[model samples]
Target: MMTVTRPLTGAVVLSCALSGIAAGAPARAADVGRSATHRVLDVQARRAGLTTAAGGYPGWAKTTAPAISVRRSAAPPRLVAGAQRGIDVSRYQGNVDWAAWAATGVTWAYTKATEGTYLRNTYFASQYSGAYKQGLIRGAYHFANPATSSATAQAEYFVANGGGWTADGKTLPGMLDVENNPYGATCYGLSKTAMVAWISAFAARYKQLTSRDVVIYTNSPWWALCTGNSTAFRLSNPLWIAAWTKTLNALPGGWPTFTYWQYTDTPIDQDYFNGSYTRLQVLARNHA
Candidate 1:
């Protein structure tokens, strides 16, 4: 498998510099610094959980049952309109009032669940439950550290914590968050071939247990580093691309037409939440 080196923590400092928050201001400056600090803390917390190495069946294991095939039917339930909009949430955001946000054109949400082989977000269950109670369609995400010893373990962790697929044979499946990590390696330790095998095994096991497809969430460079061929993995599973370029049209060329676009880091007004809320939209392909 190809080995991907994790970016250094200095990247976080650089991110703060680019945030346009002036340095050494008064109390307001402190707030900006606090936000930057929190952002780094969130990333560190997520990375800590994602680095564990325990779980998932090995590739050599016999296929006890057939792998579940994810089919996109023409009549899939529409979670959002063509201009679908939603947000991703975690503990950092805190106690989201889903009902309040629902009124603000926030149509869907993806919550952070597991990070790696052993750790889970303590807040995931309550937050996810809250979103559901408030009638928001929800998905879960796993902060992926492909450099860890067992990618499959990380996948299993996400599946177990996020709750297996829903009863309708469909799930707001878990996404693999493959952005740059500061402490560990990237893409795990697999070459493109091995990466494919490892991820396929992991994804297949999750599908077998949950009966839902595992979605791959990535940016262009990360995807290229891990799986050079975006189409090599399960084609039917949905793709959630993070392209924060100012224009919505700047999506990478190789990605399957994405189902969800993480357009920006800034949050929009959401009544259910105390502060700003992130926005997202479901793509038409996955709606059905």
Candidate 2:
């Protein structure tokens, strides 16, 4: 599940307000012992009207539905009871025929909208609006770059674009794509302590702006290596695990369960939202 990020050059990184670390730059081994200080923002910063964190729990209880299965190259695994189908795409899935895709039974879609402070996906507008126009529940995500930019700044950039939320039953909550740093070090050349603080700031700022928690997308090794195996986000941000295996292993970050599983990358980044279609609608509408 460890994917290499597209390397960013110094000029691009500087323009984006990201850390100065060059892609493939070496880091001192003693970085492990470094400490970081972060200013914690108010959890309830913006509104008395938006959905509180407690109210935002994705209702995980199963709803009755016919099982839907995907055939792997070998054979299709039996569908997990109550799981619904979806996919996530970036500019790489250029000019998607969203209607035709949805006709194949995809219920939801997450499109990459922004990365770091300035890198808006070239296809985000078309893909995001296209998915919604096709009657699919759509969400947007920001690929995190805590090394060059402060998390709050990047969160601000994400929300100002297509990543904002509404109570209308169409938009899924925004996601924080905090995995291996695409531009620099695996953990963005940061200490585990710094990485944790960066994520905290990003999540808090996202909540302040959108009044909804951002879904956390990561794999177990990245979670452990980058965030000191932090579970602080589990209660607020739903987990979207990236484990492409025959069997899922124990999840890191102390998550009791996952909300989405990205199972494949070939036919596209196919996934399962952990509930029925009706429950998916509830999750979309829950953001006040």
Candidate 3:
């Protein structure tokens, strides 16, 4: 009795048929060209595995990679055309020629005052004061340590060491450098609840004393991990976001709309300061 075995009931038969088609489907001359293209692409992709995807490789990965074209909403306003443009400088500890720096179009400067509870380089006071004397718009900064057991103590230290606003009763906003610090341990250490209370208290006290809004300077990581919630801190407060590549936007998942972008820390020539300064420019036309 000739028994007809059930047709090889397995994926192996199906795979064989698919493989045959994959090989024979390119019989036409036109299909041959397409097959050649696919084969070349497959080989190249295998070689580039884990490096490139449909989005393509990054700029630095290979010199042959396509240039990345970024679309900016609008060109940043020139600092010279506006009020002024400058950078914050502190304990990086380098000699700066204020006149030479000023000549490079540096219109303002923010000097580091205190780090944690301790005062930073004593020279900043003199240098900061000198910049003001030389006619550069000047402000002061305090490196915040939110992880400190006492937020009030940290605030008090900043108030004491950072000094009062200038004689004009006008000062650039008080900056709180809230980036990574050992006390905080990590970017998110200052929880949203804690941050709101701490920032509110700090701002309230700062305004009562100096009558200027407290400007919060932090990177995207800190903002997302610590202050992404709507209830955290005052949204109206000017935000200085440290985003090296892209411009701050109102979109979610991006850096919040920042008043200032700390684009680069690498030294660049400025007009109003004595030496090379990190270049920071305002984002919007309105200073608010």
Q: Estimated TM-score per prediction?
A: 0.62, 0.72, 0.59
The sequence of per-residue lDDT tens digits that candidate 3 reaches over residues 54-108 is 1100010111111221123244322232334566665332334566556766667
Preferred candidate (lDDT higher): 2 or 3: 2
Q: What does the lDDT read for residue 197 in candidate 1?
A: 70
- lDDT of candidate 1? 0.48
- Model 1 C-alpha lDDT per residue in residues 34-116, reported as the tens digit of each score: 23222221232233222222111000011111122122333422223345567776544445567766676666677767655
Candidate 1: list runs displaced more than 4 Å: 1-81, 168-171, 248-253, 268-287
Q: Score each candidate by Cα lDDT.
A: 0.48, 0.65, 0.45
TM-score of 3: 0.59
Q: lDDT at 166 for candidate 3?
A: 44
By lDDT, the best candidate is: 2
lDDT of 2 at 248: 62
The true-versus-predicted C-alpha distance at residue 91 of model 3, in Å, is 1.6
